[model samples]
Target: MNSPQLAIVLGTRPEIVKLAPIIRECRDRDVPHIVVHTGQHYSPQLTEVFFDELELPPPDHALGVGSATHGEQTGSMIAGIEEVLLEADPETVLVQGDTNTTLAATIAASKLDAELGHVEAGLRSDDRGMPEEVNRIICDHTADRLFAPTPAAAENLRAEGVPSDRISVTGNTVVDALQRHRGLAADRTAVLDDLGVEPGEYGLLTLHRAENVDDPDRFADLLTGVGRVAREYEMDVVYPAHPRARKKLEDLRVPNAVEVVEPLDYLEFLRLESDASVILTDSGGVQEEACVLGVPCVTLRENTERPETIAAGANRLGGVTPTGIFETAREMVGTDAEWENPFGDGDAAARILDAAAATDADGADDSAAATEAVQ
Candidate 1:
């Protein structure tokens, strides 16, 4: 019998990070898999560095669809992915998380009548303001297999009318990547020495959402709040700055106290998260990473899809207001150890693969049934 072929699709940094473990699993199992990059975040600094650090293989196909209007980007990816699906003819197409890549690929594969599997399915922020919410809803609805990261996510799927049988509570794959790279983290204290700081002596910060950085006032509020906390706590703050965040910081004349360095690779970021006294961020994956590493998180957004972290006391929503930010940081810095990790252990990638294999088995049975019906 021939081994099944799988096409794993990813375009952005978070997608690459979350999908790497599963790609490794496919290689170890001798499964024929091809990786496709949509070029949603094509940057030598961001995408290339992560691929190098994670040792991800060069993508077999690159759509080269760089930044554009959301509609334009999604349309381009869908058309490109449809062509790849026709050419590759893989038995299944795998997508991770709620990005334009995920929604576009899901639409392309479903239109091609291929089985779709969604990792990190069923996340909801209940805020229609987020483009990601639309992507999440569309992908979950179309997926033949939904690999939810938590039971709460599974419940969200159930509430949204997804078939219960299609949803499986696999843990989050970010935890798998974190566990895999944490061994290297122990050897990475030089990042601290380079910054002239010690472990637990500072807060780690990251903010790069259009809503936050595009608004000059909101951006300044976040910067000022972080600087105030650093001063109040007598702590240093490191921001492995996103490109947009860095540009905004410069344009707004952000204060001197907040150190804005280039974004760190996965291992370095994980080490920073592990050692930081607290983490402040507007990124979803970082929120989950903080939870997995048992670091206190202050979300710099008005809402979040990962409310489980907040519920578990591992995180709080601080939005972009200076008062909100300072209060949340003070509370977190004072009570960092009080929170428990709401995300799961490191078995998420394995469980997700197991679910996909099971889905394949069931698909085979269904095909057999159709042939019998014809007979």
Candidate 2:
């Protein structure tokens, strides 16, 4: 009998990091699968270093659809992915998270005759203003299988009228990736030593969201708050600058007191994230990682999609203002990092792949059923 074929699509470092275990699961189970890179994360370190470090196979199809305006990026990815779907004709197409890549892949696969499974599904910020909010909403409604990280996420799906049978509160794949990689990072990485910092004595900052960095005044305010955190705490703060933020930071010529470094690879970054005293960021993925690693997190946004982190007592809302950011950092950074990880056990990839493979055992005819359900 032929092995079941699955098309796994992703485009960013976070997607690749979370999806590594799933891809590894597919390989171990003798399941035929392909990785489709959307190229939204275009840099070599952002894309290739992850696969290399994780020892996962390189993408079978790279759409080469790098960043552009939102409409242009999504439209290009949709076109590129549709061409792959038409040619590969896999039984299932799996996408994760709420990037443009995820949305476009959902649209492409939904239009094709393939079963769609969305990992890290059903999360909502409730504020439609965030672009990511828009993507995940459409994805949850369109997904045939919604793998939600928390019960809250599943409940949100249900509240939106998603059938309960289709929703599974599978823990977040972030946990899976972290568990599998954290030990390796600790053993192999000298990120702390290289950066000349002691573990649990410094703050780590990652700011790359458009709403924060693209605006000059807001960016200045964020840096001001971060500098304040460093001065007040008398602690070393490191910022691993994203490529998008680099130009903006330079253009603004904003001199932050924090140490700015090049972005580290998965293992190094994971090491840095785990050892930090606190993590301040505008990233959703980093918040989850910080919570799982028992690091205090001060979100630079007014609201978050992962309210579980806040409710679990791991995260604090540090709104965009300098005062909000400074106060929240001071409040959160020195507190006990005692929140239980609300994402999931380290076995989410196993469950996700099992669900994908079960579709194969059941038969290929379910594609039509899946299509009807998703549509």
Candidate 3:
């Protein structure tokens, strides 16, 4: 049996959804790649549910390294990912986004002679306080090949002193995933019907980021504000609660006007998101998807790594303040979604594969060297 040349490492639902196009591209080209599940999400519903919906193959390796402190989680991932890399010895390991799994897998692969490719590289909110910002900075530095989502992102790498030769402007893969699965979502998903809402008649809400949900007062403010907007606008607000956020519920029925639901799989969620009149979310991916789908998005974060979304007028920043959230949602409900998408033309996966292959063709892995130079 020959060892695969590429290993795609992923954990959590967002990573799976974002990486689906790359995984499918590998299959389409008959490329030798292994899928390794890091189990950073811990729940089957949040991990495997996506693979099932996307028709992805089961992972070649599964590391059930569940939740832990940042250090513990990342450390656990490094040990487990090291075991897999040692056995597989792929020429390159591809990780997406800025989850602990991505950082851990990239670092562990670095310890070996394996090269690293980051799918969503050079994204920065510039806030070191955000764990994801830290993860992306490290991953971008360590990656031998950096697939940036936009020109702005590539410029960020250049600003950080990453070599121009290694960075490829691959559009956000979420657009690819949306294009591929949205029809399936619309055709198959009954979530809108199940929720008793008409297309463009309601707002979709997804708030799970630690910054928003961690503080009791802030979280309460967000919900209260959203509820006020929902009531005033006479629109239903459907929230698919993240498991972590669900656990911190001070009042299940708080703002009883809003409907909190179990998280939907990717397809169903996409269906809901696409036709939504307005979108309120803290997830960066959601912001990109809303932009691509021409839905007005009110990001509930002070800053976003995906600034192109806001610059294009498809999105607006609505901080954690109740007033900010309510006013942004109210004003943004009238926002036009016809702006040109700055992410890409939905060919990011192909460009990523081409860049990655070209990178490895040069023979020597430059990951460690690049990291050293950047640092």
The lDDT of each candidate is: 0.83, 0.86, 0.86
Query: Could you give candidate 3's per-residue lDDT for residues 1-375 as a string of tens digits?
Result: 687879999988889998999999999999999999989987777888889999998999999989989999999989999999899889889999999999999889888898799998999998999999999999999998888888788789999999877887777788788889888998988988889999988888888888888888888888888888898888888999988898888544458667888988888888999899999999998999999999999999899998998888999899888899898887789786678888777778887887788834431233323222222
lDDT of 3 at 137: 95
**Per-residue C-alpha lDDT of model 2 across residues 1-375, encoded as one tens digit per residue:** 342388999999999999998998888887888889999999987998999999887898998888799999999999999988888888889999999999999999999889899998888988898899999999999988887777788778889999777776667788888888899999999999999999989999999999999998999888888888888888888999988898888866444559989988989999999999889999999999999999999999989999999998999999988788889987897778766777766777887776665642332233223323222
Per-prediction TM-score: 0.92, 0.93, 0.94
- Candidate 1 Cα deviation (angstroms), residue 248: 2.0
**Residue pair clashes in candidate 1:** none
Q: For candidate 3, what is the TM-score?
A: 0.94
Clashes of each: 0, 0, 0
Tens digits of per-residue lDDT for model 1 on 132-223? 99999999999998888777887898898876668777778898898888878778536777788788888899888888888898888899
* Clash-forming residue pairs, model 3: none
lDDT rank order? 3, 2, 1
As a whole number from 0 to 100, the lDDT of residue 41 in candidate 3 is: 89
